[model samples]
Target: MTDFENVMIALPAHGHPFTNLKERSIEIIDHHQERLQTIRDASHQLIEGTVTDYMRVLFSERAWGDMAESETYAHLEHLKESGELTRASNNGIFTYTNTD
Candidate 1:
């Protein structure tokens, strides 16, 4: 299944069913942040061009470096929120994959 579908399914399956919504949302944010790092690293390895050719490079590298990790993490979060990025299946070796 797609990562998005996995998240959708796993969330409601979470324990007790009615725990703190805020805390669960934070947990989702944290999950997305980790996914962002993995996706970013993969993109860095597989794609090549000017910095702008990559989505994360729209902002300055140093500026991105300066932001708190959560804020920096939000860059990919917003793309996700806005439906700009997505999960795709791997044709071969990779899992948790995507395309540009």
Candidate 2:
């Protein structure tokens, strides 16, 4: 079963529960944050490059980056489409400049 399924299974059934609603909600949020961090760590390894090059690194270096290739690719595309990633140079390599 999935972690969510496990969480549900472990959740209190009725009046008596392991954690209150607010605590349970916080637990869920924390779980999601950890998962997001894993994905972020994987993507953080990717530097400026063409989409093809990025794919190579994604599979080679970030194979266990905690996200599916399709999902990661979609995110990369979204960044490009959203203007979060900019062209690094004349070669069409994409690089994200951290404004923060």
Candidate 3:
């Protein structure tokens, strides 16, 4: 067997339900898209922004207020894990781009 198939066979299957998790991930992605659109609409510009800049807008609107830098970073990481976004860090600064 191939190495990829061996790994898959060895992995545990006791985690969350695949369908439910996929649905939840889609919901989160949709919400994230709406937030991105909000930022674009308010700025009247293209849908591209740095994390700091976007977080400032979110904080000003009191939206996702509980999410400070770390929380926001974690959420972005979750997006990366779900294959909804890509992230990279340069000089300790993280940039995210939506795959869709």
State the lDDT of candidate 2 residue by residue for 9-66, as single tens digits: 2455554555345557677678655643443444455544444545554456646344
Once superposed on the true structure, which residue ranges of model 1 sit more than 4 Å away at CA?
Answer: 1-16, 48-100
Off by over 4 Å in 3: 1-48, 61-67
Best-to-worst ranking by TM-score: 3, 1, 2
Deviation (Å) of 60 in candidate 1 = 32
Candidate 1, 28: how far from true, in Å? 0.5
Ranking by lDDT: 3, 2, 1
Tell me the lDDT of model 2 at 98: 19
C-alpha lDDT values of all predictions: 0.46, 0.49, 0.55
- Candidate 3, clashing residue pairs? none
Could you give candidate 3's per-residue lDDT for residues 1-100 as a string of tens digits?
Answer: 1223223223225544433444455676888777655544533332344566556665655564545555555555666687866767778777776666
lDDT of 1 by residue, 33-93 (tens): 6755654665545443222234343344564543434453455445446564443334532
User: What TM-score does candidate 3 reach?
Assistant: 0.42
Candidate 2 residue spans exceeding 4 A from truth: 1-19, 46-100
